[model samples]
Target: MTDHALQSPPSAPVRFPPGLIFACLALLGVLFLPLPETLPVAGQRMLAILAFAVVVWVTEAVSYEASAIMITALMAVLMGTAPTLADPAQTYGSSAGLSMALAGFASPALALVVGALFIAAAMTHTGLDKRIALVTLTKVGASTRRVLLGAMLVIVLLSLVVPSATARSACVVPIMMGVIAAFGVPLRSNIAAGLMIIVAQGTSVWNVGIQTAAAQNLLTVGFMDKMLGERVSWIDWLIAGAPWAVIMSLVLVALVLKLLPPESDNVPGGMDGVTRSLAALGPMTAAQKRLGGVSLVLLLAWATEGRLHPFDTTTTTYAGLVTLLLPRFGVMTWKDVQARIPWGTVIVFGVGISLGSALLSTHAGQWLGAQVVEHTGLDTLGTLGVFAILSAFLIVIHLGFASATALTSALLPILIAVLQTLPGDFSRVGMSMMLGFAVSFGFILPINAPQNMVCLGTETFTPRQFARVGLWVSAIGYVLLLVFASTYWSWLGWM
Candidate 1:
């Protein structure tokens, strides 16, 4: 089958049965009854309804923002917060709830994603991604193991420039596909293992090193700011999370090397073919240079945000302005940059944030916290352990969730409440759980993450193949979280 045939359509034009959607939402209303009597009826009902809407929406491509709007409207009306159509419309517009929903759009992290997309588009336009792939493959010179290692390194380096995992995967997948075809590598064989491992590992590695590397990191920061009135600094995040990322990446690479050693001495279509294909693509264009320069300025702003005044600009505001002005400045056309922004993602983040704020403001998270604490029957270490395990389990389960922003927004507040009840050091435990939830267990399925979906498109690895490695990797990652929290966190005085 051709690529189009193999791929699923992006959206379904036919509306799903309203009865089904309402039935699910109504069932959720029932589930909220036992949540805790301490939760206000309005708050409990809102949570149940939002959660139900999000679940249904995930199974469709109904444009996340539209779904968010529907949820906001439904809540405003059903809860009698508005009491009339005009009231609900006005309430929706004036809502602190809506402002929180739009928070992700105003985040520095989203700017980075937008910047990265333009950069990736420019690189693709300039044939840079293809050129890099060819050069790296040639240097490896028929050594299968070295090629796999090179691919992982290339991806790791690319992460600094390509902020979105999906974009990075898209940029690399075609190159890998061509390489496999050229080499006559069996799609189901060891080579597939190496390709899958590198993509999965690379995605996870970047998720750790920077705030803008993944949407989840930004969501965590946003939610934390709303709940705790504090945000993690980039340097602090790198210091705390990078070591684990490095260790995990290395472990994944080593496992791939051992499990899929190169079997052939043949160069696969030879270096000449690869060079010719790359050469056909030509050098960087003017648009690429402009995009690169704009992106660099944005990165510098983020890195020195706290230290430098920069005319008293906030990083997100700076980026948004630049993104808005770049086209007028003739750096890149608005068409180019606008298409690059993941608006659906922004909406998902906003809606999640709105719901999370409601949960906190109404004391729903606190109510849930009391129930969990009472039932777990644990204190101190037991409580911390319970939180860690719960965080780990949630991370794994969230693999099925498409929106990282939505998942984090909905769950982090509850997790934070659970952590707040812990003894000794609260921030240390909270931060550790946050990191674990942000990075671990996303490799289990393609739908688990954007990068995973990107890798899946290669047709080199099946879902079963991914699960084989993912199961072990996830288990190891959780254990590492426990170890890192118990030892390193105390050493850093974060706990």
Candidate 2:
């Protein structure tokens, strides 16, 4: 491989994007718009800030962390109608401002994400991720088709523990590159394209099946529990979402294989190279075994939290992290954990939660919900019709949002508000799951998700190829999920 090919995609130099200027002007327009006096002052301010934040996030005018920080500052200043000197009992928005701007930092959901990151770090430090990938890959033997299945299986299993799609991709991609190299597959060959696409898509596809598979999934659960008072357990999410997750994962494998077949059907030396790589790693280390045990126990605790009612998910995750950091029983050090976990992700979630809470507090969801339903004529549709239409709309909406968490955090409140207007008993949990999972299905572009970007970075596949194949995959996935939502979820009393 060329030196340049091995390096990450080059970063562009700092320059002002025209989109940022437009976003600023748009925010000013919203702030100064002359409207009737019926709208709550707090709601208007919250809505304007939400619109501003959305534009800034979608346009990539600034880093996500910077946007989040700016959001915190704006919430405190713009949303507050009273002076700081005012007493709490006398002030209208002072307490609201403080709570809305800083509530996310105190959220248990944020704590869960932090703890989950430590678990991921332990997996990396102990090389458990590599061992799992190798063992799964070697079991499938040397046939190209089998190897592809093996790769998909590894990503699915890894999702149960790794939680982050990008982290799972990071672990699986290196193993795939080793397999491709061992077989002497050309860097630009069809085999390389198939392998790379599956690794990226597989990790994303399975993210919905497991509750802890992605940070956004956890955030959705938290939103439901905290905002709606509908606690969606891990087992509940798995029961409702796993069917589609499995189906879509297999669909991706078949789609990529048909779209980009390997150069040859079989590896020259069969599973020999893959097996040799696994053998080279020697037996599982004591640390790997220990981490595995801790992960398994943690997974069980989350899965049973709904029925057993033990410590909450966040508490369980933190307890596990503490176990991992113990001097003798633990597998990782605090310093190593700090280096491995992305602290910025915690910041993003904290700010996002704070903002979502502000919207709910100011009744922004109810106001915007009424407007969307009225403007879009959603109230006129039948139950299943609403599902299909909204499902399609949500799937396409992914084009405008950059991060899955941002997309969910921005739109979910509105969705909840809209559902409340419906005549029948609608499942907030059901709709929330649909919206959260749909954002991750941003197949039209590489910027949709980190895993897609990781795959594109390999340079074996182009955006054109991904779009051509992804367009149909995304369409089919949307339809398939809607069908299940209408038929299966309805029978189960979820709709």
Candidate 3:
């Protein structure tokens, strides 16, 4: 064949570059929009940059890693040339602008994120997380329904140990798939489908419960530290959020069982399959034992921080990570985990912090939050009313994006500013904590959560089946949030 004929056909061109075009339009629109008398040029510029970030993020114009770097560059130039709030006559300068762009890297919450990633890597490298899931499954029962409950229990334990929703789900999916195959069931069978959906949805449920469980949680903690001059300690976070997660866990199980009843009540040898799988491992390795001990101690330290001990979650996590890297005490070397961690998560996280800080420092977040409060009439509402409204906003807005981390980065600082501007009686930290829990409500679609996508990959379940359960989970979870706000949370004085 001729060279032209032999060559593969070129990929079809996209209809248009919507993401990049819209991002540019948004940037220009905000920059040129009517400037309120109280808003500075610098604040306006910051707002423009924020708009650009939000559009690109929602549209996914590029990788989040690339977008983070691009946003930083935009801040450096736009902010460097913009007049300072103190003196409109002088510019803020590129050096200060660069520092502002990179400020989030310095946050202790980011350090906690780094350390949590390392812990997840160590667990995967040593296979401890999977083993834990199998062992938990063996105990929860053999019937397809109880097996689903067992999956939820496994999600809870792993949420603590894995400290990553995606990683925790990754550890469970394979074991669950193996169980389905062992029973000789079709991949698309109700039992297989329900179990897979539970693994994905259950992970999202527990992400709300634990502070260290997801990157988005750490983002909220970072914002609290920066804006409120305080933080929700790990234990306090659990105290405030764990009830909703617990109730939702049961609700998820019940909804899945009701919506997708298994063809048979029992998996026959399903429990045996799990037991055999656990037995195949024979015994926990020396690495597993040491890692488990370190994890337990770290968990205790996290729970006791601010109550029994002076060290914070970040500090204690660093201690465990250090032991894991030590020569004799270490479970794995750098070579073992260097390739395992998603370092891009670290980059985006730190940059997200910087963006929020910049928005506040330049008064951009304040201006935007003021406008939102004014338009939404949030100040007219009582404490619970405001919570219900904002919680609904979070869940609704959450539908447009996949990464809750990106959504938090884009909106939370503004949310913080709104809470601050509200002329109502509410604890800043407490309200922030409640709102932060709502940010983990990524239950509507398969694309909303990494774990959901991972579970959806097995072809055992369809997106329709997932959303069928997600709709109920979200509804129940929202109602539970209101109830908790009125009673349990208020009793704790969290409202």
RMSD of each: 6.3, 5.3, 1.5
Model 1, span 90-163: residue lDDT tens: 43333554454454466554554455455565555545556666766667665566667667766766665556
lDDT of 2 by residue, 1-495 (tens): 999889998798977877677767776787788743545666777788888888888898888888888888788877767323234344456566866798988888888888888888888888999999999998887888888888889998898888787788888888888888887878788888888888877777787778788888877877777677876777787887888888888898888888887779977786677788899999999899998998899889988885787677889888888889999889989887678888888888889888888777777777788888888888888777777777677778878776888877787777777887666767767777777777677687888888889888888788888887788788888888778877887777677
Backbone collision tally, model 3: 0
Poorly placed runs, candidate 2 (over 4 Å): 1-15, 82-98
Residue-level lDDT of model 3, residues 281-300, one tens digit each, is 98899999999999999999
Clashes of 2: 0
In model 1, which runs have C-alpha deviations exceeding 4 angstroms? 1-28, 31-37, 57-66, 79-141, 265-274, 293-300, 308-330, 382-387, 428-433, 436-440
Clashes of each: 1, 0, 0
State the weakest 10-residue window (summed lDDT) of model 3.
265-274
Question: CA lDDT of each candidate?
Answer: 0.62, 0.81, 0.90
Query: By lDDT, is 1 or 2 better?
Result: 2
lDDT, residue 136, candidate 2: 93
How well does candidate 2 score on lDDT at residue 321?
87
